[model samples]
Target: MSDDKDVVIKEYTAPAGGWGSMKGMSKILPKEGISPDVLDALRRQNKPEGVMCVSCAWGKPAKPHIAEFCENGAKATAWELTSHRVTPEFFQKHSVSELAEWPDYDLEQAGRLTHPMKYDAATDKYVAVGWQEAFDAIGAKLKTCDPTKVVLYASGRASLETSFMYSLMARMWGQQNLPDSSNMCHETTSVGMKSAIGSPVATIQLEDYDKCDAIFVFGQNVGTNAPRMLHTLQECRERGVEIVTFNPLRERGWERFASPQSPVQMTVGAPTKISSQYHQVCAGGDISAMLGICKYVIEADDRAQTEGGERILDHHFIAQHTVRFDDFATFCRNARWEEIVDESGLSRNAIEGAARVYMKAERVIAVYGMGITQHRYGIDSLYMILNMLFLRGNIGREGAGPGPVRGHSNVQGQRTVGITEKTELAPVERLKELFEFEPPTEKGWDTVESCREIIAGTAQGFVQLGGNFLRATPEHAAMKEGWAKLPIAVHIATKLNKSHLYPGEESYILPCLGRMEQDMQTGGRQAVSMEDSFSHIYGSVGKATPAAETLLSEPAIIAGIAKALLPDNPNVPWDEWVGDYGLVRTAIENVYPDKFANFNERLFVPGGFWKGNPASHREWQTDSGKAEFNVPRALNASGFAEKEGRFRLVTLRSNDQFNTTIYGYDDRFRGIKGTRMVVMMNRADIAHLGIADGDTVALESDAEDGIERVVEGLRVVEYNIPEGCLGGYYPELNYLIPLEHHALESHVPAGKSVPVRVRI
Candidate 1:
């Protein structure tokens, strides 16, 4: 066991997924004490008729190697199928009050939740209770509140089958507040992309890697977030697809990659160089940088027209398939160069260099992640990306379109199956026609609104399917107060988290089977389905047995509560659907015939089925019936990045963590070890702030709400980040972000480019 100071600030120059990939497995796998058949469990993930990797939303390869999973994927598998268990006896040894004080690492490291446990106020600890007894009490409390007062929240861990059932239950219960993990992450992709092209889903496929001339990735770290993507990237680079990365951090993953699956490369051969070019743009500078590129391309076209030069913009596609082209072009042309350079933290030469790469390629695929989404101007940022792609007619092509890699495996599918706060989705009317229930027509609360309602005592109860809502959201201290005031709360989970400690008056932590475990229901056996980031539907059946005898499947637990709440759910056959997950898929197909027509039929296919994006066919679902162009309002989207000389903050994830789950202390890529309380700053900024490397400090938010929010005891480490920028790991640093500091359109928290000042 080493201390925080044991590993100083050091740069890891190895490519992201080589020998460094094995560090996590070698360190944490033995601690998990998993069964000897763990290799079988690993082999089953992301395969044909196998379990989906809980690590990320990266698509599965149709013809994958023997080891299809990545290092992070393997860590997630080992954590899920660990032999350690937090049985009833374990709970008896620790009180709820005492356990609430534990760090997130310790809470998850407690291992699998084994049985239905309820908090006993008398003893200040949890006691095992019967499933029926717990469900009955929860239903009674829920019945006391109106639909508008109750929240049905879900994380991304559940299957689409379970999500479909959960969505049905929320509607059947007359509760339209259907919020899921998407609200905090990719919701911008939904709102912005649809506004630009009339479709929220990506028009990308795994095979597109072969035909794409160039790949432009913005604001996403592929190596740590989705290591399995390296195989695709390596192959694409090998075939001459130019890879361009725009990020604030000079990540090693994009520099080069040595796949663990390749024998010769892992031992003797040189690794594949992933990125042909890498640009370390300042945080929140994507919009300005994007504007610069669009400005250059449009100007080049103007020059080509006057001087008889090579072609630049695709004028034919713009005329045939889009509207508002002139407005977008005028906005780009009117933009000044000095403002673009200043806001983008890049010089004229670098911005022009990136534009050259874009102009050289005939077909390009542009992908972005949370870096562009979790901000005040998240939607605007995404719209700019579309505006750039639209100039070249990237949509409706063989090797080109927009790709948004989601953090959760099936978050997009959850929204597709009707888990949303929006009242007017494509399938919303279909649900009413089939179920004969009038779902609330008014828009419901998102994550931000729900927290506001819960905290203000306007909301009465909360039913979470599978997420760490408290830790995942901003304003952690206030959320704790809201969790205490709820009269009824129910969490269907596979393990313990901090959110579980603050139990409601009648709260129950219901244990459920994980994705790695077989789900044996009354109908015999079940296989669940999840949608990848690219709209590909996959069937994930568990290989290992359940951790405990009392644990039930997610569908079963959701059905039980649905029955208790609506004793006579006449329109829905809860028993039938829960018994057989295939029936849930049938219902999904019934509600969404166009998207998932063959439901179960195409689920088990070798690579699964892709629900086609209509935007890919040059068809629009918007009012204009054509791909639309949207212009950014300003270069500095956040409006606070240049205010008061505050440092721009960007939240980061380590190689050992996924979402909020911390696997180990070491982040092999960024050179972090034995600590999560770190704030990586530029050496010049450290000098300016009168601080040195390894100095302890606190960060205070510059939000206008007049609230004092800070995270103390963060170690400062000098890195290659932009001078006025800072980077820190989140859930630990999540406290400093004010809840109100989120996207105005999509409401995703502005976790990426928050204005903060270091407190000495």
Candidate 2:
């Protein structure tokens, strides 16, 4: 509507998720060329026998509501089930270079891909090619590839059936470089939780939301990121279950919500208040705030010990279930209030108030997102949180545990199905026995490591199952040229993106059936399974028709490549596996018997099945044979000891977007419109720089590297964020994050808190 295209500065005071969400959902119909039949897709989404919502990894309820999907999930479904097609004719008109010039939103608007295409460098255009011919060409190049030099990147959106085959295919090819989308988002949580408890995923189930006495959310924006979670949060609030939140941005999602699906709430025009305690912690202040809370909890317990009153801490549970509590308590007891207040941008009163709530609650669930996991000390921050949870024995209980808010439907599930590159984490002997292949035991590169290899030109071949590898990782600009110089680059995808344009010597785009589209193979229609963040495995069957006859399921495509590349995977039948996905499940069962027994039978069951977390049952898989408490390197876990003029820059995703895919320019939650090129800053920070709200500014990172990372022409908007912090949309601000700036243990890029300065 605004052809002037200026980012509107008006604050949207309207409640989140009411008529606005319905209007937003309505716009998708025209934009995506969606037919009325998309209703079938929606009706089936998140249902027990239907497709899992591709928008997020939030668990589906056992007894799902009438509308189990959220606004974003609807848009994602419409985008998948769009009638618009990028056929061979469309590719014939636009060259890769020309298409690369288009914006991400425009590229996605081009709609679903309907044919396999190969890049012709002579014309710089992609031309349609037969699936067999494409697979043959790619496999021939892959056969000559160095196992260590090859990069097989999985997007985490692929089904478990595809992921299982993907891992086996990489190992069968003697390739070890298998990096995933998890390496960028929740890898810190995985590393941290796996070290403390025995689980890498959430320790709580969907039903736990109903039973929890209190919920403590850290750094995750529940409304926009996982809007479906808001329904449960609303229910908990109605039940008088307290919810405490710690985040840099006072996101609209947590402030107020009007569930559009509820006719009663809509008619009443009243929104549910979400957070009981909203702490605006500074970016990278998770550890400091948590330490303060721990210190308060410890002192409260000490007072009880002296007064001979009931002890505040779960001492008996601590004594039985955890190790090194004494060390952890002593560490917390020494934390200074002044340091905590300075770093967290909060008061001692606030920290103690939260601690009091924690002490009183018998059952508490601790949930966190990327805001806590994309900092330099991300793992250490989680360690402090885990230590706090252990003090009360939150683990191995019904309504309490640590939950890492994972993006993508199955990012965690990918790792669960043997997609890890770490030698220690890899099932080497088990894979050898099951697949009858000498699986690579040596460690391989992660996202950053793979980028380094690409930049160094050491890695020649790159294959992506379903993500934009270059755009998704940090230092993307630095590796763009290197990625172009590779010998072979292949993408298995449903639509075209900028990643496909970064063609190597030979590049191909293999169109695959989407999660919402029925995947018909030689064995008849197949139902792919996905594991949610709650570690719940459910089968997703696409009820809608396929976009084209040429489109193949991801599992079938993997099998095709396997047939051409590794003709006889002796222990495996490429033909039978694609013909029947159930056999792949059985093979997966064979590999991970204890966890995935009878995967096929349990997959389609109502409410599906939970792959039990070891910590949930108090079965410690650690060396101590019990949960261990981690002592922090220091209470100053952020390491940002208040350098003047440096703002803690947090890279955020717009409500209109998911991962690297830009849905639109507007971020409705934050009142951003007409553009994604805006920065949200506190009023004081804007005044400090002598700039008014909406002033165009330039940002330069202080990563201390010789390279001068900069992004100019950004409009600054005043918001209710912490004073010293600034927020901007990701992929645009991704340039500020350096390759070396990552979580030490997890190696996930430290994107959440990049040190940057703004210039008017």
Candidate 3:
């Protein structure tokens, strides 16, 4: 919120990790005041004996490293295990009006909420309320409203058991309005891959990285996003795998990385080079770049066939396992070279070089992130990548497939366990048969639509499991205004967040246990289950004591509310399920027999059992029963019309933060410090706009969508990004992205790619 432009922006000389990550770890460990015993226990996280890291959804190995946690994971654990607490006295000392002016980091550092509290209108303060009273009030409000007017929102941090129970309870209460965090990020990955290959999740496992001959990473900043994936990339490099990257900026993790676990590298100050070739794709130019590669592959195959040489494409695999190759090839061949070069923002030779690497590899894996999915044509871009992989028979093989790095810890698991607005008919029928309740067949609102409804004053109530929906969502100013229309707002959370501060007419904050706390239920200490990015399900048992004595586990809190709402319903057995999570898994197994059979038994496995993807096993589950090639039209130079000072904005997460949670102000890899409201721009772009390196500026949305979004006081920083493409930290830039500007089919906010005009 400060307009000062004196923020420090230095050059980080070292690569991703040598001593920098170690320094960060050392600084965080002491700040949390973790004892030796607790630190030792946290070190065993993600192992068979320990709980999982409550961070990104990156898959862990069968036998994880001795130090299984990364910098981000350590920060998350430290933040959760902090010794601070937001007691009743703290709430009495600070009013909502006073706390509203505080920053996000300050709000979180105030400590975890220790009790259930209700907002007092006259006093402008939250007063501690008994758990039963809070539940009764919420249930009363829910009972009066039509089911369609209520929205049951969820965060990715919730466990599988809790998500399943909540989904069922929401449906039984007569609604399917489940808007989750996945709807904001990777919904396109699901909708896109389903249309292309009949599968939505990643088709490859962690071990596949070692066996793959080549890897193509598009639009992901692995160093800041999912650092643990770097270990696999290093192993791939040692195996002589060709690594090619497509990004607007040269991410340090993709440039070079030194695993701190290795003594030799740490002592000698040497690191393994990650990407063999880096292609700087323009913001929103991923589809164009992918199409260029596909065109080259098709042309190379044509030349090989005419000369009677070894075919560049797998004709046999294409003929048997895939359909519509002729039409796809024809479209690719007809695409003009000039248009491809212009749209991709790269030379034709560079695109051809990438194609050569793709053709040479016997097996290849294509990994993508939000940069590819958060766009106007995100689905089409994903299909373009799948189309290239199909041309070379890269999928359904030992070490080759499509991989989408999920952003949150259990985002995929939440979706897998029926926490979705558009719940399929099969699952609906199964739930009806098992629970004797008919789930709504009508498609419900997603995150974007739900916000629209709230703004339009149509929604009656809103309840969130964990995420900071107000801060993380696009069009925050409008969202806050919409949130005021809700009659009741409930948050089941561990800590204070920006969303909790924005209360409705009747608001309640019910604090819950963190992932690292022992959930001492009626039976004994209980463990929760989660599915990783690769669909690997395993048990996570916490050994640490609870942060606050009054906090309840997520599942227990959900069951308490459910029991209050359905007081006479005898079919649910809510008490029994909360007492023993195994019963919940049993119910899930009965619901998804084919997907999660023997769900409880699998938890005892050393690592975990795979949920299985049909496409990975060479079985197509599509309407055609084959992987179909989609021929999408080539995109233009820019998705939006260009103005003199307009630039494409790509919202990014800093190295010191996660989704909507700011751990610190610095982005180490980017050499930015003590600031979140800064815009990274190309030197040429800065010069063209007559702006200096640290000039304060305001960014306004370019689209004439009738909504004016202008974020002020963001200092400009010159960086090595592509011209006409600017970068800024997320949640701050989120205000400039319109609610209506989202993916076509999935409706995911295009936060990664937005068009804006900058002014001094």
What is the clash count for each candidate, in the order shown?
0, 0, 0
lDDT of 3 by residue, 568-592 (tens): 5666888889899999999989998
* Alpha-carbon lDDT, every model: 0.86, 0.86, 0.87
Tens-place lDDT per residue, model 1, 433-481, is 9888776677778999998987787888888898888888988778889
Model 2 — which ten-residue stretch has the worst lDDT? 1-10
In model 1, which runs have C-alpha deviations exceeding 4 angstroms? 1-8
* Clashes in predicted model 1: 0
Q: What is the lDDT of residue 147 in candidate 1?
A: 74
Query: Clashing residue pairs, candidate 2?
Result: none
Ordered by lDDT, highest first, the candidates read 3, 2, 1
TM-score of each: 0.98, 0.98, 0.98
Give the lDDT of residue 259 in candidate 2. 91
Worst 10 residues of 1 by lDDT: 1-10
TM-score (C-alpha) between model 3 and the true structure: 0.98
Error of 2 at 219 (Å): 0.6
